[model samples]
Target: MVVLTKRELEQIALPAVQLAAPPLALVPEVDLSAVEASDAARSAAARAVAKACEDHGFFKVTGHGVPAPLLARLDAAAAAFFALPQRDKDKAAAGAGGGSPPFGYASKRIGDNGDLGWVEYLLLGVTAAGAAAAPVALSEGAESSCFRDVLDEHIAAVRRMTCTVLELMAQGLGLDDEGVFSRLVLDRDSDSLLRVNHYPARPEAAGEPAEVRRRLTGFGEHTDPQIISVLRSNDAAGLEMSLRDGTWVSVPSDTRSFFVNVGDALQVLTNGRFRSVRHRVVVSSARPRVSVIFFGGPPPRQRLAPLPGLVDREGGRRRYRDFTWREYKTSAYRTKLADNRLCYFETTATS
Candidate 1:
């Protein structure tokens, strides 16, 4: 129900660089073929990576070892999945009203009022069942069986990397590594949505109004509220991140490297020590953009708020009240997204 008034938000130009440049570290590509030879090298790389995660909400990871051929297969499979006829694709579509989690496809307008997100998607969850069966499910009913296997492998690889990133983020925030990992990591019923988006080339404009052009976006502007997100895309780059000063930056894809960004959940959990940023993907008339986004959330039952340890020590004011992830999800479903400020505050607690 809460939507921000147009006056509340400025419709500004996208920036050439992310408004807030993430602490970026370039990780060299590690050949998976020479795993044994690179053991010590990989461990050192991991430590360096952990440091970067602690310092910046975003980073570029390379050399951990995923192949370019595998990346190509994922790209092809994603394209193939979206290429299916509407009727066939509809089988996996979110029900009439949409809003269900994982294991389904969503239409362009699914995010309410036909917001026209840049692409369609297949949701993924981290439940025990999903973990055990996602590979089989995605592979079995698809038009191509091989694609599913490849996609599964990719997901598994990314999940491992995500864990490493999250763990490092926790350590960087000075939290007990195990506790942070146990608390913030996605769990059963926690949705790890994978949006496979394909932006079709819009028809050439015949002197259309520029305002109309703005509406023809692959994805609109907004910040992810999840703790972490991992993105992979082909050569067609349309993704942009807004910096704190409101400059936008292009995050291009390098071989074997996927773009990782922080989300709101981490910001709240770490009491603003980390950050989630505003971003969008624009579609083009000449060529379409394809991207895969994995939005990772905690299990529904988990409580989310600023960690007490991170609160201001003077008078011990807690900026955010404790709320359950399930409740937040419900609130999101009921509200007009992006219309309101994301921060929430509670009465200061005196202990």
Candidate 2:
């Protein structure tokens, strides 16, 4: 990974200037209940998804059919795990499933680059077995067993939802193969991942109000490098997305729903028709914030390019040059979080 200069890191960590949040209803919301409905209703739902992808690249989903109790269990498990002492968490890191850089627990530091944030997270790779083996459940003890069980069940449900939306995306594009996108994520060698983030509350109890203090960067700005991201969070909200005009707006916190966003890979696959929404999390509240994201990625060896159907051949050549998923993933890992990672792979003439 390219190391960032201290100056660049400082620039990235500068306090975020927050704008007033737009109305909640302004963000597009799609009801996935249509997925199981009549063909006409499904078609309408698909159209809605397509329009949202083109216009905002960020939206919410309702009637997604995920079990409420299961989500609650995972939330409770996450809370308990975060509440553990620093030493305990550090010890649990050993069981975080070894890797080159290692997949375990991380705090403050966002990446190999000098990027920093007021956040701590557990990064775990999801496998063909359908789950991520993270720090919490290493032993066969009851507590450990319960944590792994709930985490696994939660991922299974969220993974299904993620695939459903991917299929919807294909349908929205009027593709004959609705599974075109979903199949990549469902592949046995898919490089999916789960990231559990915890942004602790400000240490100040009796100080200036939240508004008086400058906003702290929880997670700096960036677009996910996968195909799609399904996010679940508690009531606390600090999420923000960059509008097409480069304006940043607060995302309304919805505890009962899931927020889905397009990623860089998806943008490439669609020939840049769908945006890869740039987003960040800012610390504006004193309450601790917890969020878990399921990133749906394809197999490393999978070749990535503009889908022939999505590319308007009559108009011109593809927007992005052909490359394997592994190539893109490697390039992403070697860049700063806020960099336009896709710029390296785009066709100069097309851009």
Candidate 3:
């Protein structure tokens, strides 16, 4: 709950060495407009989604029905908010004594160990069960009011779109009911987080060694701890994912599309059929970058385990033990940002 000031952030040093950039590969794209088409077309789109989930655990989505204008406004609002003076931004800081909500502004040096990223973010809860929660409150002022309005509108639209994608994913997984996934994710009391991230351009490290130059990261490598994440990033080229062979590939930045990533919860629910890929963002030295991510998880009280339907099809063996979302999230927050949080909840047969 500790918040670092701008001065403290500036004092943090970068790692002496950094990993080299990996080869670039395109993430598969799925045209979700098909979901509104005929049954045959819907089936085709579902199959494509299933394949992408099984093979890459990451993909880009197009024709998602969210208005481009809404995205632009959201982007503008974010840019305006982040451009504010440090003291103004600190008013929304999410830390002990910050007076902000639990899921609010977080600066660099996210962990107690001073593990830092070249980014700052505002996290807001988007859903409680299927219903929309109250819009995030902002300090009373004309500017804060406008920012709040735009963000609320954007969050509402994105939440609806995310649910649609989840339904299509369920269809592709042969869970014809579609509600199976949606029910688990959108249940009343289900907690979903919307994160608005801003990564400022790094200072040029002229003539520095490749390792030293690569040490600048917008955010470090890590897998998400939710059911799924829907992300949209401005054109800056930083997102990268690790392949099964341990090679890294840069993710394409398509402003018109949303990037979807399977998370640890989904991997467990699928009995590892889908992977939770490790990914990171490299800081750009020229222009600042902004991203909006919606992280979906089950209700805090819900116990997550391999879905019985999936387990039965996979010879009835559970790859992970049943654990409440609260328990898992608690464990996750206790560790370093990049650590494999899922390992703590793993259960062996003997246990």
Q: In candidate 1, which residue ranges exceed 4 Å CA deviation?
A: 1-56, 94-103, 129-142, 205-215, 312-315, 345-351
- 237-312 per-residue lDDT for model 3 (tens digits): 7788988777779887789999989999988888788888888887745568899998888889988888777778
Measured against the true structure, the TM-scores of the candidates, in listed sequence, are 0.74, 0.91, 0.88
Across 58-121, the per-residue lDDT of candidate 1 in tens digits comes to 6666554656787888888777777767765665544311335535666555465335444556
TM-score of 1: 0.74
Residue 128 of model 1, lDDT score: 35
Compose the digit string of candidate 2's lDDT tens values, residues 96-173: 655434477767788887678878787888878678755453444676668778878888999998988998899998
From the highest TM-score down, the ranking of the candidates is: 2, 3, 1
Which predicted model would earn the best TM-score?
A: 2
Local distance difference test, candidate 1: 0.58
lDDT of every predicted structure (CA atoms): 0.58, 0.81, 0.75
**Position 343, candidate 3: lDDT:** 80
lDDT of 3 at 31: 90
For model 3, what is the alpha-carbon lDDT of residue 140? 57
